[model samples]
Target: MTIRVLLADDQALLRATFRILIDSCDDMEVVAEATGGAEAVALARVHRPDLVLMDIRMPGTDGLAATTAICADPELSGTRVLILTPSEIDAHVAQALQAGASGFLGKDVTADALLDGIRTVAAGDSLLSPLATRVLITRFLSAPAQGAPPRASEDLGALTAREREVTAWVAEGHSNEEIGERLFVSPLTVRTHVHRAMTKLGARDRAQLVVIAYQSGLAQASRPAQR
Candidate 1:
C-alpha cells in the first residue's frame, strides 16, 4: 500500500523540494503539505496521513508542539511524526520522544536514507538519521533520566498472553517479519498479533507502543515477549 504523508516545513522552497522526492516514490505519496506547526496539525487531522515530516523550528506552533498534539489525540493515533532537524540536542530529542514523535532525520541525508526513514516510520518503526542517532546516544547517555516512565501495557489490562508476546518483540526492535520468524508464524499473523496488542494498549503507533513495553517492564532486550 502507498503510504500517505504530510510534509510540514516553514520554508516553501524546502517543502516543495521534499514533496517532489516523496511523490516520486511509487510506494509513497505526499497527500498534504503545511508551512507551519499549526497548519501541519490542522492538515493532519483533516487528511489523516500515515506519516508527517515535521520541522523542529518554525513559526506559529513548531514541529515539537504539532507532534505532541497529534500524538496525544486518540483519533490521530495511526499517524506518525518524524522530526526533521539540523542537529540533535539532548533536550529536544528527549522532549520529542516524550511528546510522541516517532523518528528524526537530518536535513542533509541522502535521498535514499530519507526514503528509508519514511518507510521505517510508516511501518511502525523508529529511525534516527545517522547524525541524529549519534547525538541522541551521547546526550541520552549523559543526561539523567528525570521522571518515571509511562504506564505499562499491563496497566491497560487489554492484552492477552499471546498479544503481550507480540508487543515484547516490538519493544526489542523486531519487525513483523522478524517477529514472525522467531515465533514460527507468518508475517501476516505477526501483524495480527501486533494489531491486537495496539488495540489493547490504546497506543497510537509503534514508537510509543515500544516505549510502553520498555517502561511497563513487559519487554526486555534479553528475551522476547513470551506468552
Candidate 2:
C-alpha cells in the first residue's frame, strides 16, 4: 500500500523539493501540500493521508497545535504526524511528542534517512533511539507545563501489569523486539502489549505513550549509557 503523505511546510522550495523526492518513491506519494498549519489540518481532513510531514514553526496555528488537532479528531485516527524541523531542539522534540507526533527528525537528515523516517512513523514506530528518547522525555516531560493540570498517576489503572511493563520499556525507547527479548515473548506479543497500553491510555502513538509513561511516573529517566 502506498503511504499517502501531506507535506506541511511554509517554504515552497522545501515543499517542492520534498514532493519530487517523495513522488519518486514507489511506496509513498505526496497527496497534498499545505503552506501553513491551518491549511495542513484542513487538507489532512480532506485527504485523510496516512502520514503528515509537519514543520514546527509555520505561521498561524503552528505545527504542534495542528498535530494536537489532527490526533484528537476521531476521523483522523489512522493518520500519523511526523515532525520535521530545521532544528531538533529538545523542547520542540518533547512538545512534538506531547502533541501526538509519531516521530521527530531534523530537516538536515539525508534523503534516504528522511524517507526511512517516513516509513518508520507510518508503520507506527517512534524514530528516536531508546537512550536518546528516554533522555529527552525524562528531561522535558518530567515536569508538567506551567499552569497545566497535573496528570493523575491513577490514570494508568486501566493497563494490565504486562501492558505497563511493555509501556515502560517503550518509554525507554526499546523496540518491540528488544522488549520481547527481555520478556521471553515474541515481538508480536510485545506489540500487542504496547497497543493495549496505548488503547487503555488513549495514546496517539508510541511517542505519546512515552510522554504518558514519564508524566505518570511509570518510567524514570536514567543517565545515558557511557559511550
- Leading candidate by lDDT: 2
lDDT of 1 at 108: 81
Candidate 2: clashing pairs of residues = none
lDDT of 2 by residue, 1-227 (tens): 99999999999999999999999999999999999999999999999999999998888889988988998888999999988876654687677787678888888888999999999999877777564575777788888866766468899889887888788888777888888888889999998898889888888678888888888878853212322
**TM-score of model 1 (CA atoms):** 0.69
Would you list the C-alpha lDDT of every candidate in the order shown? Answer: 0.76, 0.85
- Which regions of candidate 1 fall more than 4 Å away from where they truly are? 1-4, 11-13, 25-32, 42-50, 73-79, 86-91, 116-149, 225-227
Identify the runs in model 2 with alpha carbons over 4 angstroms from their true place.
Answer: 221-227
Best-fitting candidate, measured by TM-score? 2
- For model 1, residues 51-99, the per-residue Cα lDDT tens digits are 9999988987988888889988888988999989887664666567658
TM-score of each: 0.69, 0.88
Q: How does residue 19 of candidate 1 score in lDDT?
A: 88
